[model samples]
Target: ERRFSVDLVGEVVRNFTLTLWNTYAFLVSYANLDGWQPAAGGSPAAPAALTDLDRWILSELHTLVGSVTAAFEGYDVTGATRPIERFVYDLSNWYVRRSRRRFWKSGAGPDKQAAYATLHECLLTLSKLLAPSMPFVADAIYRNLAGAQQPESVHLADWPAAEAARIDPALNHDMQIVQRLVSLGHSARQRSKLKVRQPLPEAAFWAGADAAGVIARHGALIADELNVKQVRLLNSDLEAVAYELHALPRELGQKYGSRLPAVRDALAALDAATAARTLLAGQPLALQVDGMALELLPTEVEVRLQARSGFAVAAEGGLVAALVTDLTPELVREGLAREVVRRVQELRKSSGFQISDRIRVRFQASAQIAQAIAEHHDYIAGETLAVALQAGAVSADAWLIDAESLAVQIELAG
Candidate 1:
């Protein structure tokens, strides 16, 4: 007979329960499921007007379906879980997280409907894909999403087929690069002890030719993700920064056994700016040693960037880096406005206000924060679903909020 400890079983049960509850909270609460459902045709159709983010997610979904199918066919349970996990992460973290405002916007328009449809499709597809390994959880999601229209049991549903036409390899590749750059941008902010909610004036990305092109194409996304007003590709600007080059001893030694010392000395002595420019241009660095010219490929030398005095930089594999520390007065004001919005949101949550609830806000702030609120009145109101926002004293029943050492009061409308 197999024996299971009660403590171990209790822990497992608690974890499972929390996981299900969190999943439900995300789908029903965060995603606003009341407004999202499969349409009359059954499966949610791809929206007619799809943004780059939407298209990229759809492409990823197609890729995930193929991976899951292959893994299941090969009887590799662990392999199947990998794609499911990745898809879920991307769906919740990237797609839904970024598209929250679109869904929460007051009116239902084509764009809003499209966001709903895209997310709905992703969730439903994810349900069917996950049904094999997590039948109970999958059934709950599937039933709530599609039980009324489709098969009652998730197990009875057919496996989701990959839509080859929806798969865009180029877009996927570009999005992956963008994701990496955004993650590095966050790392840069964390290193500088800067909060992401604070808006920065600009961020510069130094990437290889291909990655640079993709970054340029998706510059706006990088900016938004990093909470910066502008994203500038640091192609020419790389010369302004300092670079330290280290010759890989093992690789270079194998190529030039006796000349290794000369190569190392030459590499260290090379003009940092010129070497950066040369490597960025995808050209080999030519060195003259012992009356013979030897060419050093870009890969033969590892490059490290020294963050300039006014910049905070985070680099990955020396191929990509982001600089984002400059803050102008205007940018600081905007950052203050963003901070105010966050504080108000926290107050709303604490007051037990529903996501759709509108409130009246009155604030008494420092001159700087008040000025910021005046400048971004409409923006703050829109974001927080405030029916009215003004500078004044708080009413007795109003919720009080403190942001950046400034006092604010908010009252939900009946």
Candidate 2:
């Protein structure tokens, strides 16, 4: 009777680990054969981890154990695997990439401190979740985070206390929408044959599903990341066109059997939101055929809306489509402003400028560029390590310039 909801997670993890290690081990073994020296002897990292990045990884590893323990208590293996996937795929990939500069920062500064703190938290969490699955990697990360004052092995210590307050439903929802928008943006970039680094004029999103204030609150973030000057909310006519649905073949046919056609027709009669809520909430859709009622579960259903005509960005359920809008004068200025700061920073870094190093930039360009920088002088100063920016390009030998980039050369003129 106790086996009613048995925990197979430990075995599941073991099986998954074996599959993964088999793939990894083959590569490493073959590498050793090809390299003339054993691949296992390779030192891809330092002999001992001492950097902030190392500490960050350790902290995330430890924190992850607490999460896994909580997930196990709830008997939710799927929830448990989520953070594990994050550690491997997202925390490892995105966090590591974002913080590389801090890890490789030649000099210690505020930037370095921030990078360490962020990475440490991620590492500690990841290590804790991993402890039960791969004790060695878990212990290694845990011990490193512990350092002189903390316990040697996290396993020998007490189970971590839960921090339930840290979970915010609103933030999670916002992040999910943001992630979908980002995916759509990446798709748009690919379709345009443009790299993310290339500046985009504007992006428009059709958000018929967005709650009243959520889109407004996070609109700035969407605009910034997409390099668009503005985000336009499409009209209701566009929303209807974008939200048209199509039936999923296998999903409906298998679950409903003969009841599928009636259910599909009933769903088509309902609007996107009403149909989604009714089907998702475990409420019976009440499709009657031969006077017999049927029930539909969430997973047994799949509904996706089609792309609307002239829509720059739209999402029906999880599927997304985006459209490009005309870039505003304001957007072009912001893009230019970003470019100016980037070039300035490159100049500062290469010139061995201190974080507080104040410099002057005098660029002669169309009145458009001049007015743009002038309007956002404080931002320009903060971002570019500039004491003052004067709009006039003069011949100077010391300045490093790139005119082809529509950017005049810059330097520390004595």
> What do the candidate models score in CA lDDT, each in turn?
0.77, 0.55
Reference-based TM-score of each model: 0.81, 0.49
Question: What is the per-residue lDDT of model 2 for residues 142-193, given as tens digits with 9 covering 90 to 100?
Answer: 6755445456686874555545443444555555566577667777666555
Candidate 1, 287-403: lDDT as tens digits: 988778989988788776777777777766445455667777777778888888988898899999888788998887777788889899999999998988888765434323333
* After superposition, candidate 1 runs with Cα above 4 Å error: 1-24, 30-36, 245-267, 270-304, 394-404
Work out how many backbone clashes candidate 1 has.
0
Error of 1 at 268 (Å): 2.8
Considering every candidate listed, which one attains the maximal TM-score?
A: 1
lDDT of 2: 0.55
Report backbone clashes per prediction: 0, 33
TM-score of candidate 2 versus the correct structure, residues matched by position = 0.49
